[model samples]
Target: MTANASVFVEKLRSVVGDKGLVTDARARHPYLTDWRENYLGTALAVVRPATTEEVAAVVKVCAAEKVAIVPQGGNTGFMGGATPDESGREIVLSLARMSRILEVDTIGYSMTVEAGVVLKTIQEEAAAHDRLFPLSLAAEGSCTIGGNLSTNAGGVQVLHYGNARQLVLGLEVVTPAGDIWNGLRALKKDNTGYDLRDLYLGAEGTLGIITKAVLKLWPKAKDVATSWIAVPTPDAAVELLSGAHAASEDNVTSCELMSRQGIDLVLKHLPGAADPLTDRHDWYVLLEWSSTRARREAGNEGGLTEKMEGYLGEAMEKGLVLDAAIAQNEAQARAFWALRENHSEAQKREGPSLKHDISVAVSRIPSFMREGLAAMKKVLPEGRPVPFGHVGDGNLHFNCQAPAGWDKARFMKHGDAISRAVYDLVVSYGGSISAEHGIGRLKVDELAHYRSKIELDVMRTLKRALDPQNIMNPGKIVRV
Candidate 1:
């Protein structure tokens, strides 16, 4: 290490103590690479701060020496948003040690937690109080609230509860200049000017580091109905979603679409995974409806389950749904959901693939999927397209697998071209290139190519104003 880096490391060690600082290459490997293993980076040192005050102190030392800080949480992001570069000049500021669920206000319907707390922990804490923290994701077991807020994570429940940003009431952030901005207010209304909480929520840690947050919660649902339905095409799935919303009075908690191939992979790769429907169809939808009213109070008054069944029966009669199977109990519901949750893992077993996380208007999803698939096929005819995800919200994981019998390396050679074609179609449909995942280094160039000049200019202005030295997670979101 250079003299300056050595001095910075010494100061960081002093702030976090020897136990919190990791300099060994092997020890830092896990934090430096992303969950997908697509991004590999090297850092000067991995520093774990046990408290917000320690975090600020570490940042202060790093800022004084003009060193880059890559703020990391559970490190489960598909994008390399939390990963450092290979320059060895950056320090990984991990929040794993600062995890603490500080407050749970049952009456207020809110919870306060430190940044490092796992998403599942928050959910369980809320549940113990008969409240629900509805930000559910596949990585909930390992992903941190700080990372969720940084990326504004959207999961299956977003159809009803909205994304992570919408669930948050306030945040406590450590600015790039090593100053603390305490805005952790749990009030429902404070139409303050500029809304600084939002400015940092989806900034992907480029502007500042989120140290803690006040998150919104809801009453636990007493009635939940999950079902796997078969649809003839994407158009039918869209119609079914609309019809279900009308029937349930907007109580539809989740609506996920799966291609035939997506399900086949799950059954093939995931042991004991079964097909929910008797007959196979070109497309499928795993939808759920939930109600908070007690079953006794909802007796014979058309609860969520009755509403869901009535809607599905009507849909089947109208030919919108080809077949349907509703879960009889909690175990059955979980089993049905396992099929959807295993999509990414099952696809991994197939081979190397190019994945696109894009979104369009709900009404335009059918067209987007049709056009996107055709565009990708035209570029690489032998490629297999697996388009599936939260179709209720218009976000589809448009992933393409290598043609069978071809080596992984040869298939990856066409990844760039396939992605360009798919993204171009997404743009044509007025869709975002990145739906849930933030634009880390993975899609930095695509963001530049697609975003308008004024948008890019505004982003750069904010970056320069907030992190003038470009030391806070640089080379992400916007290039400064």
Candidate 2:
């Protein structure tokens, strides 16, 4: 270990006590690696703080020692945001022990939760109070609120609820200099200057470490209608989405588009999972609508179901929808959701792949897909272009899997070439390279390359203004 690391470890252990400090290699293994196992790291020591105050104190010690510290929360990120570098010089400051739901103000329609609180737990707690925390993700069970905020996670609900940035009302963050900023207010209106909360929301622990957050909540939906539909192409899926939007604007909570190859991958990997439709189609859409009013108040009195049926009827007549299956009950709804949610997992099982989280205008999604697929196919070997995700929000996971019997190493060897082709097309189409996940270490170079000179300079200015020493999550989001 470096002399600086030894000094930092000593100081960290003193602040958090021996019980909270992990020095053993095995104990620190989990924190040293990321969720996807693509980026493994080595830390001087993993320090677990049980409270926000303890986190501040730990940061203070690391700051005093001039040691770089990476704030980690559940380490469930996809882009290596929480993983450290190979130097083994930085300390992993973990907030897992600070797990607490500070308050749930049902009347105020908000919940104050510590960064360590698991996303799924907060959802359940909100449900217990008959409210809904709409920031949902597949990793909700293991991912922490801090990671979600850092990444500005947009799961299947971005259509109705917006991303994590929109859901957050306030945040309490510990700056890189070890000072705490308590901005955890549930107020909807706080135009007190520049939006500091936003800078940290998707900063990926570069500017500060999020300690607590106040998140917006919605009235629990009492009635939901979910349908899995097969479409001829991405264009048809986009048309179907337009139909749903015309039918129910804000009530159409989710509209996900999946390709045929994506469905086949899921079926090949996951057990007991079947194709939703009888005939194979190039694309599919999972659309859903929810109502705050109960079924008796909605279907019987408000004509909610009739409106949905009418919309589907018109869509079918237009030939936008090839085949559709509306979920008969909650069980069937979950089954349909399972097929959509398991896309990432199934893709992982396929083998080494080049993943791209991209977004375009909702109307131009089909064009982006056609152009992006052609571009990727040109550079890549006989690979599979599995583009699927929240078409309602225009965010697509345009990932590439190798062809059958293809060598994983050979496919991954051209990962950079594949990424360049896709990202270049995305930029040409007025799209964002990252739709949900932030520019963590995985996309640091991409940020530097794609970001304009002025924008990159401003980001650097902010990083230097907030963290001059370059201690907090170095080589992430923006580097010093």
Cand. 2 TM to true fold: 0.97
Per-candidate TM equals: 0.97, 0.97
Clashing residue pair totals per candidate (backbone < 3 A): 0, 0
* lDDT (Cα, tens digit) per residue for candidate 1, span 264-356: 888999999988887888899999988887655835364677778888998999899999998989999998999998888887787777889
- What Cα-based lDDT does every candidate model obtain? 0.91, 0.87
Q: The CA-based lDDT of model 2 is what? A: 0.87
lDDT (10s digit) by residue, model 2, range 354-454: 78999999999999898889988888748899989999999999999887777677777878999999998899888999999777889989988998999
**TM-score of candidate 1 relative to the true fold:** 0.97
Count steric clashes of candidate 1: 0
The CA lDDT at 258 in model 2 is 91
